[model samples]
Target: MNPAQSTQPTQSTQEKQYFDLHTTGIGYLNRIREVSPKKGNPFLACNIAALSGAADDVVYTRFDCRVSGKEAEALVRQYEDAVKQDQKVLISFKIGDLWADTFTYTKGDKTGQTGVSLKARLLFISWIKVNGQLVYKAEKAERPQLEQDPSGQASQGGQDDQAEATSSEDSPAPAAEASSSPKEAPRQSAQIALPETVQLSKDAPDFQERKAALKQQGYRFDGQAKVWRLPTDAAKSAIEAQHQANAQDWARSAQATA
Candidate 1:
């Protein structure tokens, strides 16, 4: 036997592991432009005002995203005219690899103050509604398929039921709920629901780190429900993988102590 060769560590062929955090929601698209950087090729960029919280008290989280996918770039370009004309270009968006970029505000009342902007790559546009009119919807083939859990329910970190319950809550309220005065109903509803969500547990290992990561990725906390929520679209697999890894680490730690 070659003792020296046997002493060397074996190189396993396992694929490199990477963590992906994606943000999915309905948002108003804005600031569509082509960015030319000195070091890299020019790319399309845009801003999205993502809606969150209750229908009555919706909050907006702005994402300065680089349009990454070809389909997304094309879609954003198509709506440039509408956006330039000041029409509301609302879309169901999927943003990937979200992070926060801090900068000193150079103008406005908060000049010289540090401001944090959310940045990401715009990966997909599931659908678009311009001025309350449906303009585009991705075909079924283009949509991602959600994995089914052992319970036969679409698994989103056990938040499928919670998502369904609160999905409509994130959208802008209808005319009736928006005003005290009774308003005639439109022929068709214009309300758009938020994306399906996955909940983060408080008991998870490295809970704060996970929470901070999710916050950077544009996930919101449902104070009323006492859970952190993230969209369950393209992020489902990533979310499940993260929690599974957390579980394994916790089990190994417990075993080591035992």
Candidate 2:
């Protein structure tokens, strides 16, 4: 080897981490929206109020998510139904972006606190329990190979396509023909499964904490159902106002990134 080759530094390699998110919590649905910030690609966003700490000394954590996939859609639908029917349910969610920020409340008192947020771009909700009973269960969302590659080297310029073409040459039929075949064609929605309910353990620790925190927030515990209740009250209006504000903020962020 040349002397210069030995002396030269090896460039640092950065690889994307896969399957890094696994979060499970119980929180109140702050806000939910089915929006297409970009054309054709739609996503669901939810601003959730997660509970923290003991009942006597509770901290209100902000758990928010912006995600695409069928599970997200189902979550949005469930949130809507809960809102419409005036139901309070406990949930268990996982695989999302978890973060914290210290910011002013902006609504009233102009308070500042270290609040956490969870963005579930790719995630699974293990279960949802209502009234200490299992209502729904869901599995983790299946990851798409080309959608998010850990190497960050695929799909940008068709690198993966080139390799796939070579390896799948003997896959019984050409990819183009296979895609073009009417019966074998795939729908855009097939990328993920439809949203489903969660089946959480009634004894989950977080469920109790979530119930207590929600109760502190004026949510009543229904003696009939034995579940914490969420009211279609002032908070919904307040959250919608925040939604509009977020749209404005999103526009600014998009502009900055662009």
Candidate 3:
């Protein structure tokens, strides 16, 4: 409600909203690499492709990412085993870092392949269907690991699955991918897939002015929670710009008085 806070200067800042993200798609465990970034806690990097359409006309969006948390590490092991066993699965990703990346495949001068990278930090192989039977389903809060491996068509499968999946002993993990230096067209930095974050914040210095600007931009405020709520990210850039300007003005005022 402060009059001086009504008008503010323009600002330019770009903060991505895709931090905590969730996406569902078929995953590709194309390549796995062994890396020791700081040593001891070595990690396996994975390259994946998320398909959106039917197999005949599927679109491939690539992502190169790493996983390290206890639950995450276990789930990845199951993922690799599933790949070798040729199981049909769906994945849920909790993205930590993400950015634009390019993958170019050059097949002798003329054939070029390019795609978008969707990297992730924590990936949960939530559902698995083998031979049309739901053999594995990770609980909502559970990581994808079996107490025992599933049986083949003939024998009963049971912990042997975990034992077989213990590739981490032979190969630990983190991520980004592992590729030998190829003279051919190489992949760019990989990107992770994350959920989009909401822009509304309650801690801005010019809270009242921001509230007014958000009202103009169609963001609604809930008195109970004392937070501005937005239906979508359609006008987020503009609102963030205003937030930056307000912060700058406050900084300048503090300096002038000092």
Runs of candidate 1 with Cα error greater than 4 angstroms are 1-11, 146-258
Residue-level lDDT tens digits of model 3 in 1-258: 887674554454445554343443444444555556532356767666544444333344566667645665666675676655544333433444343332343664223433333445545554444333445655544543323326533221223233224212212111222222222212222222222322445553333533454564445666777655555563444444434443554465456556
Q: 6-65 in candidate 1: lDDT tens per residue?
A: 655556855667556677777778888988755456789998877676565555667889
The order by descending lDDT is 1, 3, 2
Query: Who wins the TM-score comparison?
Result: 1
- RMSD per model, one decimal: 17.1, 23.4, 20.8
TM-score of each: 0.56, 0.38, 0.38
Candidate lDDT values, in order: 0.62, 0.43, 0.44
Better of 1 and 3 by TM-score: 1
Q: Per-residue lDDT for 72 in model 3? A: 52
Worst 10 residues of 3 by lDDT: 167-176
Clashing pairs in model 1, backbone N/Cα/C closer than 3 A: none
**Top lDDT hit:** 1
